[model samples]
Target: MSEEGLEYLFKVMVVGHSNAGKTSIIQRYTKDNFSADYKTTIGVDFFMKKIIWNEDADILLQLWDLGGQDRFTNLSRAYYQQAVGAIVVFDCTSEASLLHSKEWKADIDAKVTWNGKKIPTVLFANKIDLGAGSFMKDREIIEECCRECGFIGWFETSAKDNKGIDGGMMFLISKIMELGGHAAQGEAAPTNDSTITIRPRPKKVEADNKPCC
Candidate 1:
């Protein structure tokens, strides 16, 4: 999608732990293709898509795929600039990846904002094709994490099969549009009461916290 003329333009970021399939979803969504083998995203990568809002309106979404390795964490704040929406991904099979989702969300809140407002964020539990053992076990904790981090919702996704990507993405887009995109920057951003509220995570998860090596 060329950035020529569009009714609305939004900058969105995709963030998650390394190998959690963040790039896989980007490739699947933007190019309609997926690769079994992929390189880790360095620094940042950008992609854009045009959404036909209606007959008269067109929305161009600018996507920044931020590298998720801990080494790249310091660079994330800069990459997150001007992002009005976020898609936080984690591997369904990896407990570490799932736990790190909160950290990723916290980093975003600590850094960027559009018009001094918390941007809409959603979580993606990627790689469900392999299995969802971790996801299933931590379902309650994940729901609590979503609320604590202010995520609007979370979805189980498999980029390889292209499942749940579009639906989850559009939900985020609608939220951005509801927030009035760049147009209604003057209005105060409203709280999302439907989502989970920020609170102390479950004790089990708290017990599992360990410094990364």
Candidate 2:
């Protein structure tokens, strides 16, 4: 509530099922590197990034990475309160991960009181560098997911190649500024029409086509 709405601050949670590339997306955006052997985030880790809207004002965003393991599900609900935005990411290579996105959204929704208010949520189908044929036909699946779930923004990104990371962050920042409680009362929330073109990375073919079941 800095400067009585002169500037805005937002808490955004990056959440999804296990191994959905949530941590990798955060690391790629904040650090600009991909760790092949990265460890799963145990509890929660916080990362900060500043985004400027105009010449004089800037928005400070706190991005929270929540652990997605089954044991941590009960503990993750505490982090959802008063959250302004959420990036519900899913690995495009795993069709099941996208299905799990709906479940996670429901869990978060159950914790809140609904008065026809909408949270600025973005749905990202990550790991697109793996190619289209690798994952079950994804376009129809993801489009239906967004349409049914009322997600505000949608993007396809590859954390491995660091593509679409900046655009995704910018889209979220724009949304937070538009919806930050005050704007919601008098004005329309930001339009969820962001379009990011992802350039597929050159990936090596793997022999084992095993699903991460």
Candidate 3:
């Protein structure tokens, strides 16, 4: 399930509020394993995966496994500053975690000021294996927050059951490739073609125009 004739590399940041199954997704994606008793990320961790496009250039995914702790959220902004893509994760069982998605978006916005910029984000409503009720409720809350905060896209996943995890990662990485194209074309890269927009501004003159006197 790989794309043909593609050679590019990009950085992706994994971010979310604490206990949002951020680590679980990473583990499942990178190592194909999930644990019910997984430990929280202390500071920040990272993993790399090489995606081949037509077997030409290798697009390396530098996944920044960000810590969800409140103290580390502010510190993680630096990681997002230059990230080509991001995965905003959330736990399907925690309404509070879903609510905090806005705060995560705000932190990124504060670090980087660009209007209607998509920034290649994949919102993951993790732990979907728990089925409905609390899980669906959390998903609904996060979806609303994404709408208000302008997230690009989303996917529901259950890292425990390995549902939608690979697809979500590939979807995000594929978008990174698309953005790489926009960047190569010298066009204003869309924050997200579906979500963010980029428009030109009129030129301004420092001094007020005056009639010849």
The Cα error of candidate 2 at residue 55, in Å, is 1.4
Q: Each model's TM-score?
A: 0.80, 0.76, 0.74
Off by over 4 Å in 2: 1-6, 70-72, 112-116, 133-138, 181-213
Per-residue CA lDDT of candidate 1, range 1-213, in tens? 233323566789999989999889999998999998989988888998878875545677888988877434566666776677899999988888878998888888877765556789999999889988645675888899898889999999999999999999999988887766435433344344222111111112233568889
Residue-wise C-alpha lDDT for candidate 3, range 121-155, written one tens digit per residue: 77888887886445465445656766788777788
lDDT of 2 by residue, 90-166 (tens): 87777788888887777655543223355667888888888643544646767778888878768889899888878
- Candidate 2 C-alpha error for residue 175, in Å: 2.1
Candidates 2 and 3 compared: the better one by TM-score is 2
Candidate 3 weakest ten by summed lDDT = 193-202
**Backbone collision count in every prediction?**
2, 0, 4
Candidate 1: regions farther than 4 A off: 1-6, 70-74, 181-213
Q: Which candidate number would show the highest lDDT if scored against the true structure? A: 1
Which model, 1 or 2, shows the larger TM-score? 1
**lDDT of each candidate versus the true structure:** 0.78, 0.69, 0.69
